[model samples]
Target: MPTPSEDGNASATAPTATKCDSEHTPQPQSVCEPDHRRSVVQNVVLIASVTLCMIVNTANLTGVSISLPTIGRDLHIVEDKLQWIMNAYSLSSGCLLLFFGRLADLYGRKRLFLCGCAWLGVFALGCGFAQNEITLDILRGIQGLGAAAAIPACLGILAHTFPPSTIRSIAFSTFAAGAPVGGALGNAVGGVLTQSTEKSWRSAFWFLAGMAAVCCVGGAFSIDKDEPYQLDDRRVDWLGAFLGTSGLILIVFALSDGSVAPDGWKTGYVIAILIIGVLIFALFVVWERYLERVQNGSGTRRRRWWTPPPLMNVSIWGRANGKLGVMLIIAFLQWCGFLSFSFWITLYYQNYAGLSPILTMVRLLPMNVTGFLCNVVVALVVGRVDLVILIVIGTTFTAVANLLFAVIDPAAPYWAFGFPATILAVFGADFVFAAGTLFVAKVCLPHEQSVGGALFNTLTQVGAAFGTAISTIVFNAGLTKASRKYGVEVHGSVANAPRPAQLVAYKDAMWAGFAFPLCGAILALLFLRGVGVVGHKTGPKVVDSDATTNEKTVSHPWPTLLLVYQAVEDR
Candidate 1:
């Protein structure tokens, strides 16, 4: 019932209303108490906690590769069954991201974040004691569900705590930095833990469990409980969530299990499941649309929208800038490039270069450092640059890196082919990740940010899952062909195989890995076109706006809620 006062401040029980661009000026009479210092500390803690979760989540994705030989040997895991270790986590985490994002908005970000940490820690501990591959795989899936819950909420919380353009840009930069940082750290930790004589690979799980426990304790104590608005207390779109989750599960299941299935791609079950997933996803969209319409009818103010309403906003999607849509596409494409390297590069280092897991991890440090630098620099420069041009340049460099990798051979020198490609790819990926994330942060109003961020991350994981699934198929098929043509025994350790045979299979698999980033480059380029047209910026040079729409749309002011926003304009 409260509205903005003459001076653009809100009294008790009312929300402050101001244009988003006017955030620099302090406005009194605001309902919410401002605590920039505590908010920053809490945000930092949130990052560390989420980074811990991400480390385990992504490490488990690739760590299984390093330990596959040992696991298979010790547990008698068959060739086909070993994949469940990775697939279980991918399917569970990727599918449930949107669900958790909405839950954070409905209940509380800190609450769900703590819950996810508990779930992840417990499941990680369970993995340490798992008796069989099947049990471990199931536990991995549970861990992924917890990660799915925590990650999006972490991002949403960051979105809320740092609503100002400059701070939001920095927060997103930190968030994006976590990916490459976590990825590199995961490999390093997995390598060290796997090398331990006392515990072997199980040590990795225990270490992760311990890390999650620390984060849980820190997060529970550090994060602030104050929120700008009251919980909407609306019903969760259970049917929509069900359909969407089932659809993704079916799709990923088809992708992951298809190659191992008896009939391969032609298998009836695979086809049926994929078809079902697609159909259900379509239904979910329609259901969400109906829900949106119903909510719009029930509320006069768009700010009073349903709790965690449909992940996508049609208004934003239809806008000329289409920043949200571009972000979705970038999430799909950028991750495609990143995940391809995550899945395939390890194989290249192992089979072709004959490096130990530890050696590979060390060799990858430069790229990770480069990525971190790029992330930091891009975050600093985001407010000054044109987004579309920045994305174009970065993605183009990524494509070039992928192309270089496609043609790499055993005789290729590390400095010439590998080093440059590593640098370019790392820089490109880091830049694109930061820019795309900024684009999303730029477009959203605060109330919708949690759900919006959840959607962005969901697509990111989905894309990575798809990219990994497709790349795995290509690598396996290519290896199979090279084995037959070169008369090499492909199964078992490549270390024991003939040099020529191993080299051929490794190079062929590397070549096949190009499919993902190449496709990513093209898709990202397509989406880059519309980035700055609708009152948005569009170039490589960083240019600050003079109190423009870019800042105006960054955050929403609510009179009924206590959210602080822009101050009154002189006009």
Candidate 2:
């Protein structure tokens, strides 16, 4: 059954159509936006706060890769346990995102957003002071919980407040640009900070914690607070949240652990966990459908705790905007491609190419430069052209780039193969990032915007976690085979071990890395083709409050402008 938000153009359409006589209807008391100038100031403050937070979060995630050797040496971390430092964060964040996202909708977004950042600060600080590997791993997981809450809301806030197509497009382009840009900057930051004789790996986490603390304070002031809006005040579904979160966590956990597990897929525990996770996910779907039935029969017009009707509405899927999901998936695949290769290429540069930690950082600069520039280029084009075409073009180039990387032999020169590969992959991902965000922004109704934004961000992160995990499994499997064939044990110091056969093993592992981007390109081509539409072209320029009847009469989109003043304020 369609709820108020699900219908997309019922009660909400009335006020938008009925123009204020400047006498009959009174404006709601403003929480933040009073004049255009104030609104612009508030928006800039909010964007700056969120972008800084994103950079810190990303730096914390990636900086450890370079510092891992120093950390392992100090903590006496075994070869098998090293990955957990990374997995602890990824698993927690991916699993908890859905629950936290729904909570943001039910409660106030600003409240959760602030809370998430505060918690991130605490955990990041704890991670820096940890004395043992287990302690660090546990602290990292706590840090991820905070990130899960904060990251999704960053996009949600923008989507809900920014109703203008042009402004929203630019906002998301900036948001998408933060991750890769942050990553590049993070690697450089990590390289510089960790380059000491004191071996100060702890400084990375401390830096993250300090940055998070500052951002959280600024964000708290920037956000406008009001009486929290409720979708329906439906009872929160603990059972569904539990099942969904646990299922995702376990699946990611199993995959991340697969590299260390003896016998790989043959291990009983791995298979069992994988099977259980799938079953739990299936149960979550069934439970959501059951909630839908119960709510419909109870004569409640509002959506229930699970499966918010706006997102589940079949009609949205048929719209050109719905193809945004397909494009997002492509974006997911491209990142997955990058992560898969990155996990191996880090070794390639160090082991085969004989580059130092600092040199590896320097060499990857081309990729980062291209990615950042491409994002700006895509954002410019989006203000004028079709998002679907931009995404397809990006994915096409990205796929070709991955294929190029796949064929590079052991003797391939850096300029001949590696440099071009970096440029191509960065270009592909940058285009997809900008275009996909715009597509999602255009499709969603105002009230349902948070969930839409959450889903969009969630899928990309989930894909990254999944891709990284899967590539680890593939790399390990290839290493195990190479180890057996060459009559060497695959145990101990993978990053530092120098053996002729081990180099071959690492190369073989990288060979399997090409499959992710290839599969991603195929998925994008198949699912997202022919989804272009002319948006905001024929629609009313601005919603007026005096023509409620007229607003409902036209088949045009009903822009929910009740609290959208912040988005229109000139930046």
Candidate 3:
């Protein structure tokens, strides 16, 4: 059916329409999203709003590192407790992201995005005023929930608003650039504030809070009004949400906390928690599978008063010629190397070499420069370059970066070793992140954009946790062996240990860390090797939730704009 649209064009009435032509013959109202609903200036603002928010989000992360020492001193917190200040934020954010992402797709992305900003503003304000260690840690954890709520929705809004074009590519690349720049500012701003006045570390939180407020207002004014999902499609998968959130929290907490515990992996509670989390995740998988089957009418129905859809369908793994699932694993693996290099680079400058905070930040400045440059390059080369080649480059760079850091010379010139490592690490991250994000957006069902974004982000976060934990284990083992050989306390009370042994420990960890990206690179080479012409179905399948019959199809990719490297040919 064709309807008379406001633009005096025949628009398809069915939601099956994926393409639009505001400049020509388009399908439906979704096509009218950016050009028809928003002006060019508004589009620019929309991109800027998401970009600035990304900067603020990452700034909050690295900024905390700047103030941690001062915060420890002012609050009389022990050294081990400082990890919580950072980990709490990551834990909460990682655990809740998927749930919030699903909500964004179901309800409204714009609404969720705005609320997240305001909520973040409120709690970030509280974090600044917190007087005690426990209070601050709690506030930081709760504050993380804001990011979980907003990130998926924010990404969803972009995917929804933009048609597949160079503009969307630039938007994502610009957004990627913000992360490293924000990280640099986090250190710079927190350093500036902490150095300015006594007990001024708290000012960092206030700065972030104000930034959140600004992002919220800017996004509200700039982003287009969201088109709503169907009433029947707006069901919440409550049971799946509970299982997913709890399982993720437990798993991440165990992985992260295990490295820091006194007994490390041998700790009884940590082991138990890890097992429990793994089991819960398994259960979540089964539950989702069942729900999806039921949703498709393959199973008995009317089991409950309301049958909500699966928060994430288990069959998502089988989509996109199974490249989606394989890439998820590759992305996770590559990020391990990426996160480790970023983490160890700062530690190398500070803990290993005893550089001051400001000096350490200066040493890492190349990362910001490279990240910005990498994003620009990504925007230019992305549809033109084979995606697998870009991923291979990214993984190889990270592996090399980690290896360089592992063998870094204390007396080496910064340009010879440190600078290259910093630049390579950011380049790797930006390449993978930008490409991976765009791929997920393209493959996902239009309604599942937020959930897809959440899935990608969540994997990267978990990868970071594993990277940290695995590196810590290696570092600890190296220190223990050194202590045994030297017959001293090299493994314990690092300040009391031989400095050489501690340096060896850090090197050992970094050496082990490089293996992750090496694995990623190999996998990328083997599986996601090159661009191929996208396969198409003989006929389009109607989007039906309750359809029971599973007709095998030649291909199943959603027919969105070929925003990436896939070539389109006239049939």
Q: Pick the TM-score winner.
A: 3
Query: Given candidate 3, what's the lDDT at residue 147?
Result: 86
**Most accurate candidate by lDDT:** 3
lDDT of 3 by residue, 459-522 (tens): 8866776676667667767877776667785423355557778778878878877999889878
Scored by lDDT, model 1 comes in at 0.60
Structure candidate 1, residue pairs in collision: 15-559, 384-542, 384-543, 385-542, 386-539
Candidate lDDT (C-alpha), each = 0.60, 0.60, 0.69
Model 3: weakest 10-residue lDDT segment is 551-560
- Any runs in candidate 2 off by more than 4 Å, and if so which? 1-45, 76-81, 156-176, 296-325, 351-354, 383-388, 400-405, 409-413, 443-447, 491-500, 533-571
On TM-score, the stronger of 2 and 3 is 3
Candidate 3 local distance difference test against the native: 0.69
Candidate 3, residue 214: Cα displacement in angstroms equals 0.8
> TM-score for every candidate vs. truth?
0.79, 0.81, 0.83
lDDT of candidate 1 over 1-571, digit per residue (tens): 2332432222333222322323442332122234556655665676666556656666666566555545655677654345557667776887787787666655667787788878878888898888887788788887888888777666545545554445545545455566667766777887677765467778777877787787688778766564433434445667777888888778777877776677678989999998998899888878676666554554453433344456544444432355467557766776666666655566667546767767766666666677778866764565556676667667666666666777776576788777777777776566665566545544554444444556666776777667666666665565556666756655423544566655555455445445545655566567555456211232111111121233332223222111111100010
Model 2, 406: alpha-carbon shift in Å? 3.7
